[model samples]
Target chain A: MISLKLDKKLDSSEGEFLLSIDIEIPKYSFTILCGDSGAGKTSILRMLSGLMTPDTGRITYDDTVWYDSRQKINLSPKDRGLGFVFQEQALFPNMTVRQNLAYALAKGQHSKEIDLLITEFQLDGLQDRKPATLSGGQKQKVSLARSIINRPKLLLLDEPLSALDQKRRMRLQDFILKAHRDYDLTTIMVSHDAAEINKMAQAVLSLENGKVSRITRPGEMKKVSEMTSGTITKIDESAEELILKISLKKKSGNAFQEEYATGEMIWVSKKM
Target chain B: MDWQPIILTFRLALVTTIILFFVSLPLAYWLAFTRSKTKPILEALITMPLVLPPTVIGFYLLVAFSPAYQFGGWLESIGLRFAFTFPGLVVASIIYSLPFMVQPIQSGLSNLPPSLREASYILGKTKISTLTHVLLPNIKPSLLTGIVLAFAHTIGEFGVVLMIGGNIPGKTKVASIAIYDEVESMNYAMANNYSLVLFSVTFVILILVYLANGGYFNQISK
Candidate 1:
């Protein structure tokens, strides 16, 4: 388990606020920090990765103390033994994809791992190309692959897929999941997409104004399945198909989907 | 035309530029990333050469290298005399061109996104490796600018060399100083030859830097 009691004063778009938290992250679990913009989500990940220091705190992984303000004990990021993927792709622009991965190799570590990563990410043909020549999704994939070249026990991602399109976003999510399971990593990611949280995270820490407002399991999927109904506003007579506008109740927060309806007279529920 | 002065001038510039490249790398890295309270003071001292007259620095070098002073006396005790010598010209040129070498590299380092450094650190690379492999590679244009500026600045310097190195045909008489001596003796042809050579060479060097940095040579990148 990684336990931390952190305190930091930060300035955001809305002004300054104190980000205080006391939380213990379960080992080998996928955790998500969900919040609006400027809610200290990314800052928390940075603090955990040793990229940003807390004003006062004790961060411990098992028995090793990562940081303690009073003891003056702080580990450098290199010693923290983790991987970080920034919001934007942070691949070395001057290096080819293979070279970037090779550069991340530790001493005495073999190049076979680099070859495997390139194949795993489906970047085989693009391995000899620089980052500037790739698309946004391709670049982020390379960034992810490079970060985990050493197979770290921990992974930190800050909105790594926010810039990608829907198709590419889903594609990268699968890659993140595979890496998470392949290494059994203790993953901490900051994201605002609830569906993605539901698909990837085991637990979610919803943040508001630099504070954890709630710990919610992302089971919005179950709720949506239970109460989904939409008025059949239009019917296509040519194909003998009914068009269903599946908007649930106003209280369900606007769950909507369109589907090709059958001609059966199915009873619509009052709650839906 | 005697080529000794021109050769000596290039030798001094080359040596000074080479030394400054190594020295400025560490200095620029610190200035770009440090939170030290004394940064402003140190920065001002390094940049003094840019605004102050070269003769002001030249005057101080003369005082420090003279055998009458304590420093000069100690230097002489070691059987080393920098005053009016080739080594003296190299040292003075380095000081007079310090800012030219440091500023561009510093700005290049600062302009890079912070995530590049943080990403390298999180990947389990040390500070030195991160600098050499990641930070420095991304600032190629800045490094070129610094080298070109320092080399050209040292090549054109006259006041500092005149004060500290004086005039010696094979020892301290660089092209700029030679031009001055030639013009003083009404040797306009010799002065013009030296002047045109210096001008054409520096201009060509600056043009190459501009073209390379502007992506004119970037055909293969895309």
Candidate 2:
């Protein structure tokens, strides 16, 4: 299990606030941190990855002390042995896709694993190309692939698919899920997308009033209100069950409740 | 016509550029990434050469290099002398041209997305490896600009070199000094030759850098 009691002073345009949370995540669980923008979701991921330090806190992951306040011990991200994929892709612009994956290889590790990753991620054709030459989806895929090259046990994903299109987002989500299970990773992803949370997370933590609280499913999401209007952008009849793809005013998610047709206006209410 | 000055000038420029490249890499990295309180002070000091006259630095260096001064006496104890010498000229040139080498690199490093470094760190790479393999490779244009500007700036130097290295033949007389010497002796033809070479070479060097960085060469190659 991974446990943390983190305290950090934060600044937003709204003003200064304290982010304090005590949380435990079971090993190999796909946990998602859900919150609004500037709600300190990314901050939590950064703190967990040792990218950001928490003020006077203790963090331990699976028998290893990642950080401690009194003991004054903090492991560097390099020694923490985790994979982090930033929203920006953050691929080394100078390295080709193959080299980018190869870079994450630990000292004395085999190079053949890079080729396996390339073939697994279906990046074989693009392996020799630099990041600057790749499309947005391709770059994100490469970024995700490069992160797990070392087969790190912990993976931190910060809005990894937020920038992609609807189709690319789904494809990238599959890639993430595949990596998550295939590598037996303990994953913590920061995302506000309800459908993503529903699809990926086994346990969800929502930040409210500078604190983290548990939420079971997307049904309890504040974003899905008591009643809302949306146009049915797509109606998939191919599946055994009918699925309506509705585009709401502020956000979009699949409304699996009732049968609907394309271009139909419908009212969506919070089930609970 | 003594070609010794021209040869010596190129040699000095080469040496200064090489030394400055190595010295400024770590310095620029620190300036770009450090949260230290002394950063502002060091940054101001590095940039002082940009605003302050070369003679200001040259004057202090001249005094420091003189065997009469304490700093110079220590150097003399080590069998080194800087007053009116080629090494003195190199020291002066490096100080005068420091900003040219450092600013480009510092800005380049600062402008890269922080996530790049963080990603490398998460991949368990040390700072040095990340710098050489990732950061430096990504900022090739900035490196080229730093190297060329430092080289050209050293070649075009006159004031600091004149103060610390007073026109000693085959020792401290560089092209700029040679141009000045030729013009003072009414040898306008020789002066014009040196002037033309400096102007043309610097112009070509600058144009080439811009073209390469602008992706003109890439376009052509494609």
Candidate 3:
């Protein structure tokens, strides 16, 4: 299990906001951090990966303390034992695809494992090619393969398939599922796509204003009423009950209206 | 026809280029990656030599190298003297040509995606390893440009060398100083010969640099 209680201050053109979240992630589950832009999804990923430090926080992974602000202890990213797939697909431009994978290998891993990954990712003839020469989908595949080649304890993927086509996305999703289960990786994927969330995530954390607004299982998400020409925009929950706001200008004449128990969608619904 | 100055100039250029490569690597890394508010101030200070007149720099360097100043006195205490020596010429060349060595490297490092470094770190590579293996190889054109520019700039220096080393024969009388001395003595033939050699050497060095990394410029120009 990975646990974190973090607070970070951010300043942007939109204004200042605090990224404060206290959460625990179960082991070997694929959890998706679902949110809109600037919702601090990437910030959480960075903090977990040890790429960024929090103002005040304690992050412990399976009884190993990763960070504690009061103790002034923070492990370097190199020591965190996490695989990260960046949004930009940061392949070493100078290295061939094979060399890129080989570079990511941890201490005891062998060269034969890289060959296996190369074949598994359908990167046979492309091993000698540099990243500059590869297609976008190919590069993303290589980035993903590099991340999991080391069999990290946790995998943080930041929109890893945003550049792939529809067909490629499906194929890679299968690969992701196999890798997650086969490696027993505790995975956290940052994505806002509803279809993707439904296809892959076992659990979803809905983030707003740098906090978890709701956490729901993918199986529990309710579908929106397709007959109604309206979109569910927000879901507000209280101790009493759940409130869903659907944007229905045609029916209600207002931009949005809150309905009690007439809810068609949950927060971060798999059924968009 | 003193060939010693020509040889001395080449030697000085080679040694200075080597030193600057080591010196500028860390400095360029810092300048490329640092987010401190004082970065602009530090950059401006490093680049001051590019705009400042070499003579002014030389004059100040002369004062700084004198035994009277604290820095110079400290050097003297360490059994070193900068004034009127080959080492002094090297120091002068490095200072005058620092920006030539640093700017291209800084620009190269800055042009790379920050994701490259982040990925390396996430894969458990240290900053030094990432720099040497991942970053340096990608910035080959910039490294070549920096090395060639520093070499050529040092070879062509005049005012700084004149102020600090004062044209001492075989020690500080580099090619540029040799040309100046020949012209002062009314030896037009020797001066012309020196000028032609220096000019040709510089032109050939630049031609080689451009040929190897010329495509980089062509792409930028487009």
Candidate 4:
């Protein structure tokens, strides 16, 4: 199990909002962090990968305490046992595809394992090619292959498919799903595509203004609707005040009406 | 045919090239990655030797290494001499050809994306290892260019060598000085031979550099 609890300030936002979040992920589950750009989704993943530090947080994976601000203990990225795939696909340009994957494997590991990964990713024909010669999708595949060669404990992806075309994105997504299942690895993918999240994520965490709202599977949207009540009101394009309406059941068993502006998406929740 | 000076020139150029490689690697790394407030100041310092006249540098070295000066006195106490020695000539050549070595290396490092270094850092490699394995391999062409330029520049240097090394016949006399001595005594044939050899060597080095750089460009374009 991997658990993260953070209450820290992030510079990407204007004011110091409650960027606090608490999440518990079960083993071998696919979790998606769904948010728009600059929504702290990448920041959370970066902290988990040890690329960035949190001001006040405790992150533990199984028996290992990855980070604990109170204890002043933090592990380096290499020791974190996490595989990270960046948005830009940061492959070493000087090395060939085969050499790149070979470098990532543990020392003394068999060449047959690398050969198998290359064949699985369909990079065998281009093994001798440098990254500069490969197309976008091919480069991304090589990057993914390199990241997984060591078989990390957790997989962290930050918009790895955003640079490719739609077809390539879908193809890579299928590969990611297969890898997740085959390795039984805990995976966390950050993305802005709602459809992609809906398809891949067993659980989605919506981050808005640095706050996370966890939505589980099985009638997740219905629960969200109930929590927000009338806050899901659509935008009234013709309104000057950006009006919203709320229907409440009073003690008399009758519905009561309350109107609010569109800015009240935060206040209306079933659990307060 | 007296080949002593030619052999001496080759040795001088080889030594100068080796020392400059180590000196320029860290310098280029700093210029490429540092965001310090004094980066411009440091860059200007490296470039100062490049733009200054060779004679100016030679004059400074002459004074700095003279027996009367503090640095020279310290060296003399340690039983090491700099003036009129091969080591002195090497020092003069390094200063004269420093920019030729550093500029190409700095440009190569600057062209690389920071993402590559960051990725390596996150993957458990130390800064030194990343530089040796990842950064050096990527900038191989630029390294080759720097070495060639430094070697060629050191081979053709005359003013600095004359000032510091004093043109000792078989000791400090380099190819350029040999050519000068041949010309001064009206030995046109010997001068012609030396000039042709230097010209051919420089031309071949340049051709190799161009071919290497062109190969990289064509591969990337494809």
Candidate 5:
């Protein structure tokens, strides 16, 4: 299990925002940080990947302390054995595809793995081509292949498929899913797309206003749907009171309505 | 035709270009990446030699490196001499042609995306390795341009080499200095021969540069 307890204040020249998040991710599960832009979703991943230092935090993977402010210990991204795939694809334009993959493989740790990755990612014929010559989808695939060539313990993807078209996005998503299954990686993906979140995330963690407001399990949606259906919710403007006539069927359904006060904006949807 | 000066000029240019390649790489790297408060000051310093008259730089070098100066005295104590020597001429040429070496490299490094460096860092490569294996290879064309420009510029340098090296034949005399000497000594025929050779050499270099830069010469010729 990887436990991350981050209570940090992020203040650039822009302004100060507090990020307090406490979450435990079971090993080998696909976790999604689902939020809108500017919600500090990428910031969290940056912290986890050791790209950004938090003001205060303790992040531990199993028994290893990846970061601990009290102890003044922080591992670098390379030492942490984490792979990151940036949204920009970040391929080295000078290197050929084979050289790029070989760069990630440990020194003297060569095998048939590179050829396998090239073939697996459908980059067989494009090994000699530079990143500038490759298409957007091809570049992203190369980036993915390069990141996973080392078999990192964790994979941090920041909007990996967001740059592609819809068809390419779906194709890359399927590739990611297959890679995740094959490696059983502890994966953390950041995405604003709700459909992507639904398809890939075993647990959805929503970040709002620089804080993780919700960490819901997969089955919570069924219960939320069941509860929302049975409540007769009314807002009384004179007293500013919310009245919920909760019957048995209404009790299981419209639970979010019960939890939220009347006149407070909430998204109501039927069970999908 | 006496080929000694021609050989001497090529040697000087080749040495100057090689030395400038090493010197300019770090300068270009810092100019491209650093956001320090001193960056603009350093950049101005590097470009100052380009704007100033070569005679001015040569005058300063002659004074600072003369046998009477403290630095020159110290260099003499270490069994080294600077003024009126081939090495002195090289030093003067390098200073004279620094901008030609640095500007192209600086532009190339600046135009490169920073994401490439960040990606190398993320892949666990150290800064030195990233520079050697990643950044340098990507900027190969710029390095080539810098070398060609510096070499050609150094080959044509006259004022600085004249002031510091004093046109000693077969010792400190390069083609440009020799050409001046020939014209001064009423050897117009030899001067013209030297001029033709120098012109052809320079023309070929310019042609290569234009062709490498993707047919700019063809468009201009048209």
Candidate 6:
């Protein structure tokens, strides 16, 4: 288990705000830090990864004291066993994909494991290519493989799939899940996509104004039906299928989609 | 007509560039990432060479390198003297060409995404390893720019070299100083030869740097 009681003072373009977080993250669970923009989600992830230090509080992982203000003990990020996938992939541009992964090899990892990772991530023919030569999805795959080569105890991902299209996103999501399961890493990710959170996260921590305003298990959280109510405005049957356009409540300008009959009211929140 | 000054100047520039390459690596890295309150002051000091009159820098270095000062006396006792010698010219050249060596590397490091460093740290790599294996390699263009600029700038130096090393032949007289002497003695033919050679060499180096950087003008235009 990783326990944290941390506080930080931040000055943003909006104004100054206090980020006071007290939470426990369970081991071997996929935890998602879910919030709107400027809710301190990325800051929390930085704190966990030892990229940023809390102003005052303690952070402990299992038996190791990662940070303790009272004891003046704060370990550098190098001393903390962790892995991070940045939003931009952040692969070393000068290194080939194989060298990138090889540089991250932890002690006791065999050379065969590098080959296994290259094959598992579907980076077969691109091992010798630099990051600039690879496509977006390929870069992300290489980045993920490099991060986990060390088999970190904790993995932190900062919206690793935000830039890809739906088709590619889904494919990479499966790869991510497979890596997580195979490594059994305690992963914490920051994301705002509700469907992604619901599908992947075991627990969600929602932040509002730099505080954990709500915590919910993915199984117990309210589904799309409870959050959105709309009226069906139009129906299209041109493609040999029925599709309804919904005008949501209080926002009449935008229309959404759900399976419904015209002139009927519907509660639809799932993205089309 | 003498080629000695040309060879000596090249030797000095080569040594200065090589020494500064290693010295500026760590200094540039620190300037790129440090959050210390004195960072602005340090940056200003490092960059002072860019704007300060070369003669002023030469004057100060001359005083410091003189055997009268404690620092210079200590150095003299250790069998090293900087007054009007080849070593004096090198010391002056390094000081005069510091910004050329440091600025590009610092900008290269600063322009990289912070996530790169953070990612390396999380991978459990030390700062030195990350710098050597990751940061420096990725900034090849900038490193090349720094080295070429330092070399060319040192080769073209006149005022600092004149003030600190004087015009001693075969020991401290460099190409620029030889050019000055040829011009003063009304030896236009010799001066022209030196001028043409220096101009051709600097031009070729600049072209090579541009080519190595994938046509710097094209990148800017795009």
By DockQ, the best candidate is 2
At residue B23, what lDDT does model 4 achieve?
A: 91
RMSD of 3: 8.8
True contacts kept of each: 0.93, 0.93, 0.82, 0.40, 0.45, 0.90
Quantify all predictions' global Cα lDDT against the true fold: 0.87, 0.87, 0.86, 0.81, 0.81, 0.86
Task: Output the TM-score of candidate 6.
Answer: 0.89
Q: Which stretches of candidate 2 lie over 4 Å from their true place?
A: A217-272
In model 1, pairs of residues that clash are: none
Better of 3 and 4 by lDDT: 3
Write the residue-wise lDDT of candidate 2 on A1-272 in tens digits. Answer: 99989899998668898999999888999999988788898999899999999998999988899999889999999999999989999999888888898888999989999988887788979999999999999999999988998989899999988887766776678778888988999999988876677668888999976688665654565454423345667776542324466654532365444432222222222244
Cα RMSDs, all models = 7.0, 5.7, 8.8, 10.8, 10.7, 6.5
DockQ of each: 0.80, 0.80, 0.66, 0.45, 0.47, 0.73
Candidate 3 chain B has its poorest 10 consecutive residues by lDDT at B213-222
lDDT of 4 by residue, B42-91 (tens): 78877887678778989999999998999999998999788999999998
Off by over 4 Å in 1: A218-272, B220-222
TM-score of chain A of each: 0.83, 0.82, 0.81, 0.78, 0.79, 0.82
Error of 6 at A119 (Å): 1.5
lDDT accuracy of residue B90 in candidate 6: 88
List candidate 3 stretches off by more than 4 Å.
A222-272, B68-70, B216-222
Where model 4 places Cα greater than 4 Å from the true spot, the runs are A1-27, A53-59, A63-74, A210-218, A221-272, B182-192, B216-222
Cα lDDT tens digits for candidate 1, B177-201: 9998999999999999999999999
- At residue B169, candidate 4 shows an lDDT of 82
